[model samples]
Target: MSETITVSGVVATPPELRRSSAGVPITSFRLAAGQRRYDRATNTWVDNGTNWYRVSAFRALAQNGIASLRKGDRVLVSGKLKVRDWDNGVKSGTDVDIEADAMGHDLRWGTSRFARPEAPASPRSNVEDAWAPEDDAAGGEVTDAAPEAAGPSADPGRDAWAVPGDPILADGEPASSPEEPTQADVPF
Candidate 1:
């Protein structure tokens, strides 16, 4: 029997996606969850030991999980948990695994942006494909040529990221060689 549980942890391993013998998609990875305690004596947080869980997802979940999950990413997983005893010829141990029902990045730990994936040959893809160069009969490598600049930049040779009104010439060369700013030069 399996128990439903929610686990928040860092993905300890890169997710691996594969096809089953029956052609079902499967994605699996290892998760590491650790406990942290506030140590008043030291005025700091201390990490306890970590628990490891093997996570697996199937079907569409497997495909998306493989695409989104990477090692060291903090994730929240809700699923059925299984504990089984295993005894190899040389050793005996217990395995903890989670068959994920739903999983995603843990927002509390960091920020994430969500974008729905679309099928190929999209309008944006068509525009991108136009920039790609075709391979020749001798060279079988396909690569994208440098994209054309939209138009002539107002100052082509100038660093586009230069400070608003510091020192630049019409030809886009620096008016003077840059020097480290002393504390006095700071407005603040």
Candidate 2:
């Protein structure tokens, strides 16, 4: 049977990163989800239950998780349910895990912003300098290129340029000048 599950919980620990035999990056962590309840007689607050699930994230997701996540941070995880059974010298039982497809911080807790890091002024090696070239194709070293004239130029008078057999205007009609406008030209 196919099932879909989503859990929002606090991270119980920092992600543990490791590589598979194939060298794929994987990170494993535990998530703890809990809710509050009230006793009918005493009317005292109590934890209903805490569900702890092992979560695994792969590749880029794993890297992001390791960098951005911390213990006690709340996150939302969505993915398929996985159950594993293991038998060793000590003990064995089926453990529930989540093969997380998407995991991210619940931003309602806080907000953050990122700024781009400035490029290093001087590269250490020739190889690094060669890989990231400083010059344009014309071989001139580029400090900056003029932005406005960077694209193909168009004639000021023409409404639209015509390709060989394809004419811009239909039935040989004269092209509409820029100054002319109709009801459609009015902005809402």
Candidate 3:
């Protein structure tokens, strides 16, 4: 059976990073999701109960998540759900755990801007002629000129190519009429 699940919620606490017995890095945190609805009889907002999940990340993902996330940060987590059952002599309890495949901040709450760690050292080559200068009127240095306007001759012989009863194509094809096409005649 597939046990994979995805959960999107707010980080309930800062991620705690640790190493496994085999010395692999891991980070764990809790996520809380809540829903609200209006009660018809009460005419007030009602809590639809909150879902909490334990989330874990591994290696580089764990390191990044621990460094980037903080308490109350909204995030989307995708992974498999693992049920952990433990008995401490007297009673056994079960909890939901998520082995996170991917985790990232939910941008709807706020905006995050990232800057390049370092600027490239190499000089940029003028691969396009867009910046090449044109000769100035005084001939001292090159400069850009205003773009020229289209002339009457620009459309020379264009209209002559049209044929009578050829149904003048609007722009490229025949103009669409006001009538809506029926389902059978409609192109998918």
Using TM-score, give the best candidate's number: 1
The total of clashing pairs for model 1 equals 0
Q: Candidate 2: deviation at residue 55, Å?
A: 0.5
Show the lowest summed lDDT stretch of 10 residues, model 1: 142-151
The lDDT of each candidate is 0.78, 0.70, 0.70
Tens digits of per-residue lDDT for model 2 on 108-152?
787533222234466556543444323334443432222223224
TM-score of each: 0.61, 0.56, 0.56
Q: State the lDDT of candidate 1 residue by residue for 66-153, as single tens digits.
A: 9999999999999999999999889999999999999999989987655445444536545433443232333334322222231243
TM-score of 3: 0.56
Model 3: colliding residue pairs: none
**Which stretches in model 2 have alpha-carbon errors above 4 Å?**
112-188
Clashing pairs in 1: none
At residue 122, candidate 2 shows an lDDT of 63
Candidate 2's C-alpha lDDT? Answer: 0.70
